[model samples]
Target: MKILFLSLVKVNSLSDRGIYTDLLREFVSQGHHVTAVTPVERRDSNSAKIEVEKGFTNLHVRTLNIQKTNFIEKGLGMLLIGRQFLRAINSNLSGEKFDVILYSTPPITLYSTVRKLKHSMNSHTYLLLKDIFPQNAIDMKMMKKDGILHKYFKSIERKLYNISDHIGCMSPANVNFIKEYHKYVSTDKIHVNPNSIEPIIQTISSKDRELIRADYELPLDKSILVYGGNLGIPQGIDFLIEILENVKLENVHYLIVGSGSEYQKLKNWCDQNKSDHVTLLKFLPKEKYDKLLSSCDIGLILLNKNFLIPNFPSRLLSYLEMGLPVLSATDPNTDIGDILEYNKCGKKVLAGDVISFKTALNELLSSSSKYQEYSNNAKKLLLQDYDVVNSVQIIVDRVEQVKFNQNV
Candidate 1:
């Protein structure tokens, strides 16, 4: 099958590991010809071009910087990105036809582009519902609910859903949210297709862990609780600071390694309350980050308590891949905490509940036997539920089913 994947993530090569790249690699391994259309943001100073590689082609469309920029630019960039992508596709791949059009939510501005391609190539469109928009924006208080911008994006969201032949949500909670709010969407079209990756299975030796921790100035004797991802508003940064301010455990340490809009805020707090227990660092490269993550004893996840949308962060896969038990402080709406508890891989507490968070942390840190059990369960859960092969198979099955229905 000829597959076209649309995403905001910049993928320079399939050799790099990430959820989207891993999924695309799986498609290539399954004998599918994949064309991934991705952005080359203005900050990168790259021109639009197409690179043909083994098993797939990557079309890089130049656009305004949509990530880690001011709100005006990000908003404008998303608004204009779809048109930019369509023009690039027509110019470079005019002769190409796609069997399946697979795209993920983020911008949600690809409605016109997807509609045009689906009609032109007679392709089946699949929506990888990673982030629910407008609502999330409202949740962050970035956009006012029922305001002009919200109403505008809401219409686009509906159009995007309407054009999609299938919508693959990240979890059961997401599927339920969509079903309840978007009653016009058919239930048959929605299914759980989680954030998956081709997990690299390896363990850092005790010596290596100690070395890595020493390199980062992290104490080897303490149980390191690491939060290694975007430090943005959606992550409930205030609550994380609260935990740091109040946590008095001598055997526990906090390691935060990421850069985002909220990085400065967290840095300011860390500066004011300088302590030996907490270490804050900027984002590291993937290889280095993974090594640092493996050196840590626990993985941390945080979400803003106000979110109505269930956001399943892809960072969970990284933590699980390393066999580190997760500790999530998230909004009540997301089921990430539920999954962690059900699999016995970790624990979760409501965001802003510092007491519960500390208690769970103590439980995970108190018993070595229980920690090992949770660690083992983490790896098992990754293999059974979050593997990229499963995601690839689910998409292929859905595409085939769509084909059969069209024929019937």
Candidate 2:
């Protein structure tokens, strides 16, 4: 099968711990051709856009002049990216046919490019619905329901949904929310395609882990709780600062390993609050991240309470694969909370619940036996369910099934 991926993020290597890479590798491994269409520069990258390729899947980075200095500029950039991508496809891929076109969303305004590519390449489109759009904006009070921006966003969102052959959501909660909003979309067509974690990097040994930590100035003596990947809108700086002020566990240090648009804001907040237990670091290379996560004691997830959407961050899966229990500080009704509770994979507290968050940490800190149990469960569940091999198989099988059904 020849698959074309339309993603907002651009990376050189296709083995990174995200949806774009996860699925790309899966297709390539199954002897399929996969080409990802991504931005000139990663919108999420705080440092610089790095091109990477490791096993089979190769990334095709598309350049775009994203004038996203401000909100209006950002909106216009998104519009142009989707608008311009269509032109790129029409000219470059008109002769090349694709078996499937996987389009991810958040900007939720890629109808022109996706629709054009769908017909131009004569491909079946799959909407990998990661975030709920205009509704998420409304939840954050960034936009209003009946406002002009809301209407415009909703318009593009509907067009994207209307044209797609399948809508794959990360969580059942999101599937439900999307259905509630868009009754026209058939529930049968909604697939739960989760954010999967690839296996841990096996090349790094215990000695290698020790040396890497020493190089990074990581405290190997104390237990390190890593909060890796993304430090932006969903995980607010205010909520994280409150956690630092509230949770005062002993012999445990918090290592936040990633940089985002809000990294400086969080850094300033840490300095102002005089947070001694917490340390912030920029995004590490994939190899280093694998080494660090393989050695970490605990992993943390932090999100604002206002986020009603079920956003299961891909980082959690990485934490689990390392056999580390999660300290999932997220919303009350998110997929993360449910997974942690059901799988017995560590503690979960509603976001902004400083008291509960502190208490949960205290419980895990005080009881070594309980911590071990949760950690073991996390590793067990990671092996059983969240493994990328299993997820990829499901995706491949399902795509074939969808194809068969379409034929029938």
Candidate 3:
């Protein structure tokens, strides 16, 4: 089968270790030809081009400054990305016949393109529902509810949902959100397809770990609680700062490593206050970050308290891959905490509750036996629930079923 993958994230090589890239590699290993289309947004460049890298074709469409930009610029870039992507696909892969058209969420502007592909080739369209849209924006107060922009994007989101032949949600809560609220969507179309990854083998001797800690200036004896992902509005930066300010401990140190709109806010606060317990760094390369992660004692997950949508953060997979226990502070709506608790892998606290957050940290710091148990559980949960090979098989089975029904 020939598969066409669409996403905002760049996946130039199968060797890339991430949620989508790993799945694309799995598709290839299963004897399918995969071609991915992703954007190459260079602020100074004013051209769109196609390139082939590492045995896959990529359409790098140049667009306005989209990611990690001001709201106005990001919104404008998102509005135009769909049409630009469609143009690139039509021009570059005119003769291609894709058996399966797989795309993920973020810029829900690709409904028209999916519709065109389905009409042109009779392809099976699948939505890897990663991020739910306009509602999440509204939850962050980035857009007003029922406002012109919100309504427009909401309409587009509906069209995208309708275009999908199968919609794979990030969790059971996410699946329920669509089934209960969006009455137009058929129940049979939704499936629980949680975030999955291809686990990597990372070995670091005690000497190597000590050297890595020394190089990064991380404390050798302190228990490091690391939060390594997007430092954006969705993370509820104010709440995170409040927790940091309130939780002053001698043995517990916080290390935040990522870049986003909220990064400057947290960094500026840390600098001005001379926060001793917190260390904030900008994004690092994947290799360095993974090593840094392995050295950490625990993983941290954050979500806005106001979110109506249930977000299952992909960073959990990284923590699990390293056998590090998780400590998540999220809204009640998200079931990330539920999963962690059920698997005995970690503890979860409601976001914005500084006292609960502090207590959870203290609990982890207080008991080594408990921490060791959680660490073991984290790795067990990863193998049981999040392996990419299992997710790939689910997707392949869905495609096969769709093909059988079509023939019948």
Candidate 4:
């Protein structure tokens, strides 16, 4: 099977970041030929050209930057992206057939792009719902529900759902949301295929932990609480800082890893408010982040408490896979809340509530014995409910079913 995956995120073979590597390799290892396409950082007219990083012979990448100006970057980004993608697909399809056209939504307008490709190739199409748009933007106060942009985006979202051969949502609540919002869509077409973490193994380098601590100038005696990944609209940087202000104790240090546009905002806040127990580091290579996290006392997952729509962050699975207990602070209504409660991985705080977040942090940091108990339970849950490899086999199975149905 030749499967072409479309994503907005860069899945660099050089970086051990993001789920794309695991997802790509998983399909490739299953005896399917896989190719991926993503947008590159905006280029100047002086140096604008397509750059391809051929990691594997089967894995083909095409990079083009549509534009990089402040005005409507995302909306404009996809327009430029769509043009380049169609050109790539046409040239690459060169006498070969793509059995499945797989894509995920973000700019959401990609539906227009993918729909044409699906028709051109006459292939089965699947939507890997990584982010639920418009509503998520509303949750983050990025857009107004009654605004023209909202209605425009909603129309595109509906079209996207209508065209998918099967839509795999990252959380069960997301499935419910689709049914509620897009009531006309077929229920069976929407399935829960939650985000997962690929388990990692690091040789017990005694100093990897020590070097990480020293490089960050972190205290060796304090129990480390690491939050690795995007520090954007979802994570509630303001809420996070508030929690740190109230909860940073002598023996508890909050080590934040990863970067985003909001990274500097959080860093500036950190500097202004002298919180001794909080340390901020720019995004570390995943190998280092993963290794440091595995040895850390707890992992933190945050979603703005304002988001009522069900969301599941991939970070939860990563922490659980590392055998680290979580201090998850998010809306009580999310699917992650249920998982945290059911698995005893950690405590759930009200999304964006400083009091609840502080309490949860203190509870987790109260003792090593308490942390260990939660950590054990977290690992058990990972093995029992969230093993990515085993679960993703189910994903491939479903895609095969879509193929079979189309054939019939």
By lDDT, the best candidate is: 1
lDDT for 366 in candidate 2 is 72
Model 4 earns a TM-score of 0.89
Each candidate structure's TM-score, on Cα atoms with residue i matched to residue i, is 0.99, 0.88, 0.96, 0.89
lDDT, residue 19, candidate 2:
50
Per-residue lDDT of 93-152 in model 2, one digit per residue for the tens? 557678888888765778877787787677888887878788788877888778998888
- Measured with C-alpha atoms, the lDDT of residue 138 in candidate 4 is 92
Ranking according to TM-score, highest score first: 1, 3, 4, 2
Candidate 1 Cα outliers beyond 4 Å, as residue runs: none
Q: List the residue pairs that clash in candidate 3.
A: none
lDDT of each residue in 1-408, candidate 4, tens digit only: 777778777655523445666766766666767777665555533322333443322323344453334556656666567666667666655665677777887657778778888887887788888888889889888899879989998888889989998888877788988899779889988988767655553343547667767766888887888899898877877888777776657777888988976799999988998778888888877666776776577888888778867878887877887777887788766878677777777888776677777777788778878777887888888777655676457667887887688789
* Per-model root-mean-square deviation over C-alphas: 0.9, 3.6, 1.7, 3.1
Candidate lDDT scores, in order, read: 0.93, 0.74, 0.87, 0.74
| True-vs-predicted CA distance for residue 262, candidate 2, Å | 2.8
Candidate 3 local lDDT, 1-408, one digit each (tens): 888988888765678889999888887777778888887776745466676655466677777788767778887888788788878888889988988899999879888888988889989899999989988989989889999989998899999999898999999999999998788998888999889998874666889878888888889989999999999889988988998888888998899999988898998899899977888989998878998988899899999999999999999999999988888999999999999989988889999998888888888767889888888889889988899988888788998997788799
Query: Which of 1 and 4 is the better model by lDDT?
Result: 1
Each prediction's total of clashing residue pairs, residues at least 3 apart in sequence or on different chains, is: 0, 4, 0, 1
Cα-based lDDT at residue 38, candidate 1: 97
lDDT by residue (tens digit), candidate 1, 1-408 = 999999999989998999999999999998999999999999996787899988899999999999988879998999999999999999999989999999998879999999999999999999999999989999999999999999999999999999999999999999999999999998899999999999888987899989998998889889889999999999989999899989779999899999998999999988887877899999999989998998988999999999999999999999999999999999999999999999999999999998998899999988999999999999999999999999999989998887898899
